[model samples]
Target: MNERNRTVVTEFLLLGFGKLHNLRILLFIVFLFIHIMALTGNVLVVVLVVFNQSLHSPMYFFLSQLSLSEILFASNIVPNMLWLILVEGGKVSVDLCIRQFYLLAAATITQCLLLAAMSYDRYVAICRPLHYAIIMTFTRQLQIVIFCWLMGFMLSLIVYIFLDELDFCGPNIINHFYCDIAPVLELSCSDTSSVELATFLESFPVVLIPFMLIIGTYISILRTILKIPSTIGRQKAFSTCSSHLTVVCMYYGTLTSIYIFPPSNNSVDANKGLSLLYTLVTPLVNPLIYSLRNHDIRRTIAKFLGTL
Candidate 1:
C-alpha cells in the first residue's frame, strides 16, 4: 500500500473463462457466431430504418439509434472477448483497457436512456395520439437522440476521470472478460473510496433516472392501453409497445442481475455468465424480438428479401 513499494501497472491480464481450456474452441466458435449475428441483425435494422420510407416514425428512428449503440457495444467487447476466450486469457495495456471501458460504459448508458426515450414515444403514440405528431416532431426527435448519446459519453467521461486518478500497482489480473469499473478498481492500490463514491453518485443520473423514466412511461402506457374498450383494440394497442417492452425487460433484467443484485464473492463465474447474456445474447436477440413480434419490421424485411 505504500507509494514507495508500489510498481506501476502497465497492463492487465484478463482472466476470461480461461479454466475452460478444453472448451475454448467451442466457446470461441459460439461467440464468433454470436458476434457475427448481432452485427448483421443490428446493421440490418439500421439500414431498414434509414432507407425505408415506412419506417420513418420516431419509434423506428429511436430503434435505429439503439441498433447503432448495440453495434458499438458489441464490437467494443466481443472481439477482444473472443481473443481472450481463445487464448484463455490475454494481456492488454492500461490505455487500451481504459478505452474499452469508456466505450462500453457510453454504449450501455446510451442504450438505457434510448430505451427510456422509446418508452416515452410509445406513451405519446398510444395515450396522446392526436398530439403525437406535434410533440415528437423531427427536430425534437433528433434532439432527444443526440441528448442520449451526449449524456452517455459525458457520464462516461466523468467515470474515466475518476478511474484515471487511481493508482494501480501490482496484481494486474482482472477476473472478467473486460475492464469493468469494479474489477479494474479492485486492482488499484490507491485509496479508491473517492472513485467508488463518485461512481455511486454518477449511477443516479446514468442508470437510475433512465430506469425510473421507463417505469413511469410504461405505467402511463398500461393505463392508456387498459382504457380501450374492445379486447381486440386493447390487444392491438398492447402489441404496439410489446416489442420495446420485451427488449426493455431483457435489458434491465440482465443489468439488474449483474450490477444491482451482483453475485456473491464466491460466484464470480455466475457474474461472467450474466455479463455474457447482456453483452452477446441481448444484442443478438433484439432485432429478432422487434422484427418477429412487430408487423412493420417483418413486412419491411419480407418486401426487401423478396426483391433480392
Candidate 2:
C-alpha cells in the first residue's frame, strides 16, 4: 500500500476456468456453442420486433431493447472468454480490461432500468387494461426506452470513473472468466474500501429497487388474475406474465446472491457459476420462453419460417 512499494500492473492474466486447463478445448467448444445460440436467438427476436409490424407493441418494443442489451452484454465477455479458452493464454491489457468492464456495466445497468420500465408497462396492461393504450402510448414508450439507456450510461460511467482511479500493482490475475468488478478491485494495490462500499450501496438501487418494483407489480397482477371470472381469462392473464416473471426471477436470483450475500471461501466458483447463469443461460432461454408460450409470437415465427 506504500507509494514506495507501489507497482504498475500493465496487464492482467484472467484465470478463466484455470482448473479446467486440461479440458480447455472442450470448454471452448461448449462456450462457443452457447455464444452462438444466445446471439442467434436474441438477434432473431430483435429482427422480428423490428421488421414485423404485428409485434410492435410496447411490450415487444421493450423486449427488443432487452434483447439488444443482452446481445451487447454477452458479447462483452463471451468472445474474450472463448478466445482465452481456445488460446489458453488469457492475458489482457489493463486498458482493454477496463473497456470490457465499462461496456458490461453499461449493458447491465441499461437492462435493470429497462426491466423496471417493462414491469411497469405490464402492470398497466394487466391492471388498467381499458386504459393501457393511452397510458403506454408510442411517445411514452419511446421516452421510457431513452430514459433506460441514458440512466445506464450515466450510472455505469460513474462507476467506471471510480474504477479508473484504482491502481493495480502485482498479482494481476483475475480469478474469473471476465473482468468483473470484484476480482479487479481485489487486485488493486490502492485502498478499495470506499469504492467497494459505493458499489454495495449502489447495487441495492441498481438491482433490488427494480426487483422490488417487479414484486409489487406482480403481486397486484396475481391478485387481478385470480379475480378473473372465467378460467380461460385467468389462464390468459397468467400467460402474459409467466415468461417475464421467470426471466426476472432467474436474473435477480443470481445477481442478488452476488451482491448481497457475504463473500465465502468458495465464492469464486459460486460467483463464476452464477455469472454463467445470467450471462449465458438467461439469454439462451429467453427466445424459447417467449416464442413457445405466446401464441402470437409462435404463429409469427412459424409464418416467418414457412417462407424460409
Best by lDDT: 1
User: How close is every model to the real structure, measured as TM-score?
Assistant: 0.97, 0.95
lDDT of 2 at 121: 88
Across 1-308, the per-residue lDDT of candidate 2 in tens digits comes to: 65476669989998778777899988888888988998998998998899999999999999999999999999888888888777675799888898898888888888888888888988999999999989999999999999888877787877788888888887988888888887888788888887787677777777878878988999999998899999999988888888888778777776676656735847778788878777777778877788887787888888889999
Candidate 2 segments exceeding 4 Å error:
1-5
Clashes of 2: 0
lDDT string, candidate 1, 75-129, tens digits: 9999999999878899999888988999999999899999999999999999999
lDDT of each: 0.92, 0.84
| lDDT value, candidate 2, whole model | 0.84
> Candidate 1, clashing residue pairs?
none
Off by over 4 Å in 1: 1-3
Positional deviation of 109 in candidate 2, in angstroms? Answer: 1.5
Model 2: ten consecutive residues of lowest lDDT: 256-265
lDDT for position 239 in model 1:
96
How far is 1's C-alpha from truth in model 2 (Å)? Answer: 16
**What TM value does model 2 have?**
0.95
